[model samples]
Target chain A: MAAARKKETFWSEPISKVDLQRPAVVPSGTSIIDAVKEMKYNQIGCVLVVGADQKIIGLLSNGDLMHEYVGSTLPGDTPVDTIMTENPFTATPALTVQEALEIFHSNPFRHMPILNGEAIEGILSIRGLMVFISEHLPLEVMNLPPDSSLIATHAAGE
Target chain B: MEGLKEYLTRQDFVSSSEVRWCPGCGDYAVLNSVQNVLPQLGLPKEKFVFVSGIGCSSRFPYYLDTYGFHSIHGRAPTIATGVKVANPELSVWVVTGDGDGLSIGGNHLVHALRRNLDMNIILLNNRIYGLTKGQYSPTSRKGQITKTSPYGVLEEPLDPLRIALASEATFVGRAVDTDPKHITEVLVAGAEHKGTAFVEILQSCVIFNKNAWTEVSDRSCREDRLLYLEQGKPLIFGEKRNKGIILKGTKPVVVTIGEQGIKKKDLVVHDRHREDPVYAAMLTKMDYPDYPLPVGIFHAMEKPVYEVELVKQIKEVTALKGRRNLQGLLRGSEYWTVSNKGKTIKRSTGISSLANDESKVMDERIHALLKSTDPLTASLKNTIGKIFYDYDYKRSKMLSPRDSIASAIALFKAAKIECILVGDAKRLYGILSERDIIQNVVLTSVDRDRMPISSIMRPVYEIMDESNSIGDVINILSISGHRHVPIRLKDGGFGLVTIRQILRFIHDTVEQVEKKESEDK
Candidate 1:
């Protein structure tokens, strides 16, 4: 008899499997304008405000800036810490992508800072996880073209 | 005016938040195309506002840096209307999906389009509910099966472009997500239009309803399946550009240009600006297999913008009324003032008036009736034994410690009581109340079906003596939050005293006092 196959789960995959990019990091006292410039240059959604020890103190996103200071009287040179979310949720490299996805879904955030014992590792993004999952999906689904024959008229449920 | 400020680029419109749509979703292309086209419209970034209802396509506002409103489900059009009416200078854009617009906000969409407001409305038609996860939408084809419609949808799909034309939209167009260049051009044209411009973009969900527009969007076959409509040109399509649509007695027929001797002039000429919508409506009905789907502007005409007209009317009325104050307008002609003595004074400036004496009489009578029903407190000095015996203690359910929580709950429901006594009458074990069941059994992971009552019941060995005053029971109940407490009867029988008994005593006392007062009067 053939050995029973072990079922694989999509969410339980390790975070390392995701194509994480180096996170954009700004000093705690960095101006909002400069921090935004770094974010724009890096082509990332957010930047991690780190203390002198290189530990994440807060995280700032485009949404935070737009809501708090975009059209407000606050000057462009204001410290980014004033608008950053203090003690943002962080996950370690050992965490599963499912746990990261849950954090992203529950909160209005699109990016999360990955850590390795107080050391900044990389940023795990929802888009990155989606790309990883898409690559792992069956080619028939990932590369599906608009074809009438592939359309299912009835649900697979019996 | 154009050279004063630097021209905005596509990057200026791109938001910092990550575009979280699924990979290969057609929304990404649409977002990119809009971001690219908005810079060319010569409007400041702050002047544009994107309003969206709830759905996957509604996330368009978040991906843009412009001032946007993520409104409630199926209400994007109403919110957009309000935004535009409040500030006609702002360029408002309403983004909605098939489910959000056609299914729930259908009335708002039709009316908004019919009014011909100076704004842009983009309907991302994927023909499926993507955000709620795989449900058939109002635009889902008949006989198409989805999570909600297991046997297949029985309703005919709604054509958004046809609806736009029916609503008398000033500008109506269609685009496909796969063709980003075309979407950009159509969006720019819609944005520049003076009145309401409704564009229906056929996109793919990639997850729930993947490849929904494959026939018209697939790159390998799109050219042969789609006819790009241009003004003054014949409706010609197909890979070789030989196939053309010719009107045959109000019906469109696909004919070969050379083989059938059907010259270009013999085909139907695309004239989108025609005053009548019959030609545009015909273009909207063309579909795959029999006819190539039309993909450009189906109709465009000049109309009086609703917002501009509304502002003009408001200004005219203000001038005619000579700027009347709100107070004077509200108190126009006459109004009444009710005094503390219940007398309603009728007053009118240079007009007739009559007093409403009947209302005053009814008010005074209601006040007098309310004053007679003041609450009378019960005597707390009454002995616990007196109240316990009157409570009909025999009705209190008694169960064994081995009884399941389910049985205890059943007994509580059957007896219409909040608590049940555990153990025999002679030997008291504990008291099990609904609060205990909810707090410990129901809310916890413990199984109510198999778990014994003893697991959640409160052990109550300190029984109140019958000779104790009612005030002492009240004190104990208030301090411990206990709904029911055991009592040792004077006759050496076990009984239960509940908080409901005290409330009943108070109510009866108040009723007796009221009766006596009435009789004396």
Candidate 2:
């Protein structure tokens, strides 16, 4: 079984990939109520605020909505720019699940957006990563692999 | 301490928030111990403040009637620092769990101890993340399993008492949750200490992580496990006080009081106020099963608190140099004259200037992403875009190409889409569109350098996912200001679902309902 596993490399399997396309963005001036409505209609948990030339300026998460909009004394019509966490942590598509998990753990937020150049491709959540890990790796291998081993291997050659 | 009885009450110390911990949680015992000790301190309840980070034990502030703040995880120390600095008269107490304090908040806790901040920090070492449903905490013993650590933890566990002693906390102590009297006494002593007093409480997480410290808290605790330290008393424990710790060279050896010709003077005498931390750290390292676990104050010393010293320095500096106003400081900087002032220019003109300047364009893209409908997308784009655009191209040799690619993908995922426009600091690269997924290697045929997005004219931008809530989609769109988005499945597969499709669906559903209502009418 060990010899067979060694021969059948896990990396050789075609790992599923997320699309790396640019996503729609919202501007900072958008009202919290309008942003919340947009999120509700779009069925998403967060909105990214960008400037006119399509540079990401800040992030507004569901937590922000819960804390700043629903939980705050401010009117629902308050501008999203006021409560958004400016310059949020970001990651790229090529980042491994392990690297992503570390960032998520160390940082405050549960959800991090994937960036490609000037555009956003997708949002990665801790839950999503966990699901990915459970589906891809066996339960025994979950804690067996050191966190360092899970880091993205970029150096050339074995 | 004589008139302490009339000064405070349990009701005066309780806060308005309803306690939400599970029944029989160790937190209840610790809470009761704290309340029982508060009246003994001869201070008004209003003069006390509780700052707690996120955790089950961090809920201490909620149960306390005093002024308190339920701060973010691992930030109670910072908050406590501010509270102590603001009102030196007020007694500040920081309540944190093992996970909150020793794990995530270790940095803050160590610094707070090192600075000897005038406060009492109670680290409830429950060895699990009780609030988050029993994940392995920093103080969890090696080879312990939990929800997150389904297999035993491979990393070495942190010893809170040793860490405190190492950090030079003026007052360092350890107590157990089961011993209410001892816990209360230690709390009172910690409160009385003028400088930073750090105490570690070994509490059990009974529900999710049960029986973690069973060996230590078992019925044979007195006879077999505990090593209670008292000032000027010999290091002794056991039912008959027969066992005593004696120094053999540098290491401690357990010896009977009246056996092996070991004299009473040979036994180590407790000196908690010793300035040197070596002995205190050694005492803290004593663990159960192998060695008798040391409890009670290990180290207590006097040091100028960070808050007190900061306040004094601030006062002296302020008195010497007059406080400067914000407006004066802002206006003092060199000002530039512009040809056009207060006149709004066309959006096209703004873009033209931005296009000419690469840095300016990069800044604009960052701003656009930040203001996008999706906050996560905007945040991700902004963070990565700024790093890419602002990084010195001359020093680009140091850049990790893999990280760059990963960052780009992360940005795209954060945007909640499949299509992304890859760009260098100077200009846009090939558009990684959804249709480019020709047998998986996306954009495999397209030349990354030569292919401008104008060549790919099939409206390649696709809706990423439909399951995403309207709030999330809007947040992304608002942040990035893009018309289309790409959605994905739970399994990480691609599916295009746009904001326009959602709007259209809602419009159609509403129209259908309205028509039905009119027919019924």
Candidate 3:
């Protein structure tokens, strides 16, 4: 008989796979306030700033809003291009889970946009990593390993 | 002087960790009660252990001077179970909140109680997820407005007391955070109980779930709206003490005293230790606007503690057989060996398998030479080689053909790691973490299940062209406090550069200048 098993599936399986096609574009001249409002309406945390030719330029997250407008003295209507993260990390659809995990560990941001060549594809989240971790690793190994094992090893060495 | 109370002072119980929660959080009252009751029990601080699930209340462990674990979400009971069974002498307490305990951790809570674990579980029901900012919790009343529930909650809320009694909890009680004296009294009683004691404390989340329970919590309205239950006393609540509950047929009926010619004896008396839970369940449901809400011990009974029973069973079995050594258990597993270890196979893909390919091997030798001569070109070549070789077209298509999911996960993890640099974002324009996904989707159990990546992908912070001046990039990074910024290439595609990379670039430039000066000298 088959042993009972907790099914393993992608964490993103629940959320619709995000599309990066056409890349949600905002003009560089658009105000950060308007960008933030667009983000809110879209129910997203960041927006891509684009040039007139629809070429990708910079990225802005809610974090940018907090620093530039909420926390700082800057006006909300300040242009998004002034505060957007310029030239953000890009990944193709062909990237593996291990490669993506390594990038996340080495880089910053809990989420990143997927790019297909110059165009946006979709986004990924840390929850996906957690789901993967939950399936691959035992509960005890998920965090720091138990301290008793270290003590036992020390005794053996002594 | 010889009691546990003598060994502990209110300050002695407090840990050195700074209290970062908002000032008026109900956690303060709960903490005060635990500290006050601990000394009275005369247990040494070393003998006491506190386990907590995640939330504002989960911070209980950090503030306590004793040994504690601020564990992951909704898993405190499981951890506390491990701690208790490992060392039965330690006095264990599990501190949880409405969201942490009732919503996510409900399964663990019920099982622990049913097994009758000897622990005092102080459930602070603030009715909102305070730590995550005002999201409607499982305990948040229907129609309550919250950060996630802009239109108000349409789902029914779980009643903790009813849940506990239904689960056959050995001891069940309720208390108010504002009533410090009563809270302390109930806590001491809960701790003294031999079996699992589930005490639900009606707490206030002043900011997010403001006035959520105002009708029952207000002091002026409490006398009329709240019903304080005591063993052997008539069920009564009123400003003049004129109102009381009496049995009409099988149901509890609220009535006025003296005017109806009904004496206090005619009123329903609370029997806390009753073996049957039917009456207790009824009392929990009585939340009348004009009647006092019931508080105090609703149920109490004796049962064998799960830990003690487990240990007892283990000892009995061990007596018949020899005790097992830790070393033996660690290394005694059976092993298997495979025989087909060194066979080589031909590759069907464009590249020849290592065993069959000779020209491919010569190419690697030349590649190594190029790597040593030009490091940058070698790195780029190596990246492309690795990407091409590792690509799995079939699995990639099945999992995420567009690669949007993986990219989003990468970006979210990056943002969370930089949390110290970026404060909380109350709103989401694009996604940053899995928490954002769970909060926005899974909690509501919405279906985005099989749709393509483009359907869910939100526009995240933009990437700039590599031609963009380093100074301009630095200005954006410093202002946003983002360490990793995606660099958009002029032609297309992108490259990621981190703050560390920029700093390293500057350091490298300075070293180059110093070397040139030394050579000139």
Candidate 4:
């Protein structure tokens, strides 16, 4: 339990230091073909549309694609705005990692838009944090400490 | 002598709630000592209310015949303050522990003492949260190994008496429950004293933190290891009665009287009335094996009490201004507009937006939000993060099957829940629900309080996972009629979801559709 442990404010780290790997961006009228192709190439989970002033007006994650577009009656070139969650929760580059994490953890939606006063700065995906953790802590078995006497035993030598 | 017959008896203070602490717990002695003193105080039984926070000791209210409120963990003082303020005639006694008083309730305890509220705070210092089975409490000594602190607790334990003294508590005392006579003396003084009388009772938890007070509690060594303080009397203790405490500047030194020319006159005499708190602080700070632990009143002085002063202030304020009745107060320049039918009427608050129809619709949105169901179910994937409800197991009122059916009823009634898990911290053996009780209990002639929950427990049917769709949940609920269902935790533990949440989804979907159609019209 890290109740007593001091948590690092990872969000305070500059946006430049954050992984800015381009989350696929497409225009409103872009066909699903282009969005899918971009996702396949970049191996990213979602796409966002930036309006004229580079403001994020809408988003389309894989959840929207699978839950609605895949099996339903929507046309491929239908505008992304028609399907995206309106007035979605967002964050700013200046947000503390604690605040960002709270937003990420609190919501069912995973992808969050990082803004610079309504202008899209970038997008921070929950996967980015996971990747950051996995990189620091590799997926290898953590060996126990070498004190062999620490193992559970009977009160007597037997 | 003439008023002897008017004095209330101990039997009158006994309540019907069974005293459920473990056998041999020091709490039994302390409870008897308190009940013994209450009658002697000459206050009517109705004048006394024992308020306690969560701990083994917090159950004091249930066993008492007097009116009591069993408050939440560490916040008994807050409720007691409300009770005292509302009715200044009542005598409030707070029963808290090291965990409840120092750890979580520390903030409330500090303010209550500092304000010098008219109440008696009897802190049971067992140095552990015994109810939670054995976890290192805030007062647990450093390097004390416990369930939570397996490697050993690293934080230094708190000294509650010292804190009480530091918090400007008007009267502070200490007693070891092992010494029954001494406990009675301390509790009597605690009840008589006005303002906050903080008494720390050093008690033993036989199961955990056992023998913590052995030096002063054990019969063989207690005489030498504990010093009972008396005003104007030189402190003396030990098997031979030859040992005495002498002051070396501010520090107290244990000296064997008549050894090396040490005389009883040279020893420190307790001055309970000393205005300064330094003497009390020093007495409370003394540790065992160095200086004998000081018991009995450490400090006793008077200050203007919070309740008395508040009442006086209210009276003074009313005299200074005019007394307005409820109707006049409500009608004080506030405006309201009402129309029965199609006619438009305007009575201005002048801020007018509140009267606007659009704002009314926005208010409806807030209502919808309040009644808004969770958009998603507790599925195989993580949905919402944990909340107060998710920690129900930790907060749930649990009982062993062998525990009295009365305890189960009390717990269920207090929590206002449909069921309670029957077991200990280790595992849930089964759950007892209202359905089980109704189907099995009231129909039969079983004695309600004596009946065991085991006879009526319904085993948990099954565990649900996040992968279960809302439809799957609906089907399960329809077939089994289980109101509450356990779900797999995202972090490998377990969580719970209730049918209420599923029903909320259906309600929210209907409301959303209704809103859409309304907007279109």
DockQ: which candidate is best?
A: 3
Over B75-127, each residue of candidate 2 has an lDDT whose tens digit, in order, gives 99988988888898898999998888987889999998898877999998878
Per DockQ, what order, best first? 3, 4, 2, 1
What does DockQ give for each predicted structure? 0.01, 0.01, 0.03, 0.02
Interface RMSD of 4: 28.0
**TM value for model 3:** 0.49
Ranked candidates, highest lDDT first: 1, 4, 3, 2
Record all residue pairs in model 1 with backbone atoms less than 3 Å apart, i.e. clashing. Answer: none
Q: Model 4, B178: alpha-carbon shift in Å?
A: 0.7
Residues A109-142, model 4: lDDT tens digits: 6677777776666677654543332232111101
| Whole-model Cα lDDT of every candidate shown, in order | 0.78, 0.65, 0.66, 0.70
lDDT of 1 by residue, A1-45 (tens): 213223225557889778887889999999877887787678676
Instruction: Return the clash pairs for model 4, or none.
Output: A11-A97, B379-B466, B380-B466, B380-B467
TM-score: model 1, chain A: 0.84
Model 3, range B1-521, lDDT digits (tens) per residue?
A: 36657767777788898877787777787888888888888787898899999999999998889999999899998899889889999999999988889888999998888988899898999888988998989898888888888998999999999999989998999988778888888888899999899999998888887676767877777778878888889898788898899987767888888876988888999999999998898888877563457889999999888988998898996897657676754444322233476333222233322223454455455334323232211222222212212332111111132434334433344443231111112222232333244233322323444433444534446444455444445444544434445544344433455544443343344345547769999
Stretches of model 4 off by over 4 angstroms after superposition = A1-158, B1-7, B324-521
* lDDT per residue (tens digit) for residues B182-252 in model 4: 99898888777889899999998988988768767888888888898887788888888899888899988
User: Could you tell me how far off, in angstroms, the CA of residue B14 lies in candidate 2 after the best superposition?
Assistant: 3.5
Model 1 share of native interface contacts: 0.00
TM-score of each candidate structure, all chains considered together: 0.50, 0.49, 0.49, 0.49
Error of 3 at B220 (Å): 1.8
Q: Please tell me which predicted candidate would have the highest lDDT against the true structure.
A: 1
